[model samples]
Target: MRLRVDLLPHGQYPDVVLVIDVLRATTTAVTYLERGADALLLTATPEVALALRGGEDGSPYLLGGERGGLPIPGFDFGNSPVEATGQNFTGRTVVMNTTNGTGAAHTAAQTGKHIFLAALTNAHAAARRARATATEEIAIVCAGTDGQVGLEDVYAAGVLAEYLLAMGEFTVDDGARIALTVRRNSGNPLEALSSSGHGQHLGRLGLGEDVRFAAGLSTSTLVPALTLDGDPPEGTLRFTAG
Candidate 1:
């Protein structure tokens, strides 16, 4: 078994991929399942998310996502972890589209069979499950901000790398190493998160609690694993508890 970490660059596929967007998308998704969500379905665009489950027909689909750090016009929920609280997702599906996270997830689904959502909140569970399944290679993908590297995602990736290293022996790339270093240097993950560009953005939007929420490490025993349960072009990346 080989363990590797890297960003989800376009067209790069591995045996299995773990997607991270800790400053709230991936963290929020995991939180939903931790609460009671049956599954989450991610899409690259809002139109696709809306198309997957149309309204008024007794479907358990609820639209949720964000753009430019703001909730979509008609979304059932925004990209906030706090916003997901106290909602009833039992036997329902959350069809989501985000500025960066869902796009990375969609791209990862193009080639990988086992896709796992990773974040500081569910670090140990995610790494354990990912390391157990992947045989050839594992890519810890960070959903960067608009094609550029975001510090928060990289920091969360670093946490995943550390957990993966403790689980088994493997080779880590420079990207992984850099993230690991960040994790090592971080005295308090929340402090690191509070200073990141996205973290500050969320703070400005009155979502500072969310930034703290995303940085909560290993607080959850649940792992959100993405399974392909439908056909492509309009396929669903369904989340199941692992």
Candidate 2:
């Protein structure tokens, strides 16, 4: 198997791709699944997220996400893992539209066949799952902030690369090597994450709890696998909790 890493969806058609957004997006998603939400659907933008469901029949679906790290005006959740962990979303679906995370996932959907959401929270679970797949290639796509790379995402990418490389079957490129080095040299996960631009951005918004929640290393045993529930162009990815 071959391994590759890129920022903000470079598209490699790997059998599996881990979409990392450690600042909060994917962390919130994994929390949603672990907290008992049935499925999490990703959308490129807030408008598309709203377009997926509207009017009187929007019941059983929760509107969640953020713009620029702040809660959207009408969203029920704002990409915060701490908030997600505190709520009870049993038997519901979360429709998400985040600034960068979901957008990166949407871009990855175009090429990756089996996409998984990865964060420090579920890094080990995701890594092990990807390793077991033994796919021809595995791609680590970092959801960079505002069209540029973010330090936290790269750090999470490094954590993921460590486990994938440990599987002893894949070859790593320089991008993957850099990520691994970043994680290896990162002194403390919480400190590194808290000092990141997006982390501080969220902290200023009083979402410091979310940053702390996302910083927990390998705290979960869940791996969220994306599955298409309908046709393309209008298809929604159902985050399968396993």
Best of the candidates, lDDT:
2
TM-score of every candidate relative to the true structure = 0.93, 0.94
Reference-based lDDT, residue 206, model 2: 88
Residue 52, model 1: Cα distance from true site in angstroms: 3.1
Candidates' C-alpha lDDT: 0.82, 0.84
lDDT value, candidate 2, whole model: 0.84
Cα lDDT of model 1 by residue, 5-74, tens digit? 6654465666888899887889889878876887888876898887776676886788889998899987
Q: Considering summed lDDT, which 10 consecutive residues are worst modelled in model 1?
A: 227-236
Tens-digit lDDT track of model 2 for 116-208: 899999999999988886458889999989999888999999988888877786788888988888888877789879888888888898888
Model 2 bad stretches (over 4 Å): 230-235
Query: Residue 6 in model 1: shift from native, Å?
Result: 1.9
Candidate 2: TM-score? 0.94
